[model samples]
Target: MSPKNYEIIEHSRGWNGYFKLDVYRLRHDTFEGGKSAILDREVLERGHAVAVLPYDPVRDEVVLIEQFRPGAISVQKTYPDMPLWLNEIVAGIIEDGEKPQDVAHRETLEESGCTIIGDLEYISRYYVTPGCSSETVTLYYGRVDSTNIGGIHGVVDEGEDIRVYKVSAEECFAMLQNGQLCNATATIAVQWLMLNRDRIRKETSALRP
Candidate 1:
């Protein structure tokens, strides 16, 4: 295996709004044991985010939310089959001095009207597109009672029009297979839950009220 190495030479900030953009100039060691010329790369600086899959041990269901995404709209221009309304787990940007699990709990309530009880089990952390964006998401699975979790939720001031849905684990998998839940965070969380759901349920069973 080849050694991985890179040195950042410059990071010039461009835009600063909902998300920031920066241009980098740097170089790295080539596979041939040589240094390549300095290269300029533009990166979207979307800070770290947190996502959680709210699961009900008793009902064996997961809570998901549907909302419009402008990013999906841009993709739809090139791929018409892509959906503008995305189905995703509860997610939000992590604020300074806040832990990922805290964001998961807060977002769950604001986005799905569901309360995440018990300790949140960390699933994984991943970058959305390291090649062009500096966005990484920490994913988790939190215990919740999904029996009556379906409803319209989300903070109105933030322009969030989220519709919550509580579906069985099987249904969530089906949605993923059929392209309904194609977002990265939700897809990863659902797949992880599918693999460890039984153990998660058993461990959290005592914590549920």
Candidate 2:
């Protein structure tokens, strides 16, 4: 038998615009087989997104981009010397009717001018901020050619001013170790690559004729 564990008391809109904020009043079953008291929670509705770290196994390098994040303004006040511009992996929200893999390829070229070379290696799928935001991200490690992956690239209408560049895998990992990388997706992807780089390099090398 299955238990109906949750009940929604009320669902309402807190704010709706470029992004949505919703309010939920609900109650759910507790661990001791009891119903929890009614709770009020505000959730930011960001939906789904995709992020990809571009790696050039042949050159032992990675493609990264720096862009100014409007949300970082408040963060810089609390964190000492926090730069307004953050280095991050290529990412974008998944549009309606669009596939995650398609968004990975599209954003990679639009943001970094780097085209993926092979199938993307799936890394993880996670909620970015489970406590407050309804945003989940699908992450990947994409193979690319880093030979010409340097310049400023982004859609002009989107107000993006991105500076793209390539760095040796060693340098990228060192940035991770030194607390220089702050973007969540970048942080996760880099840590994952650190563990899997050896196998990834071997596989890529095997493909070389």
Judging by TM-score against the true structure, name the best candidate: 2
- Give the per-residue lDDT of model 1 (tens digit) for 128-197: 9999998999988888888777879999999999999888999999999998988888889988988998
lDDT of all the models against the reference?
0.89, 0.93
TM-score of each: 0.93, 0.96
Most lDDT-accurate candidate? 2
lDDT per residue, candidate 2, 1-209, as tens digits?
34568998999999999899999999988777889999999999998999999999889998999999889899878985887889898999999999999999999999999999979989999999999999999999999999977989999999989999999999999998887798789999999999999999999999989
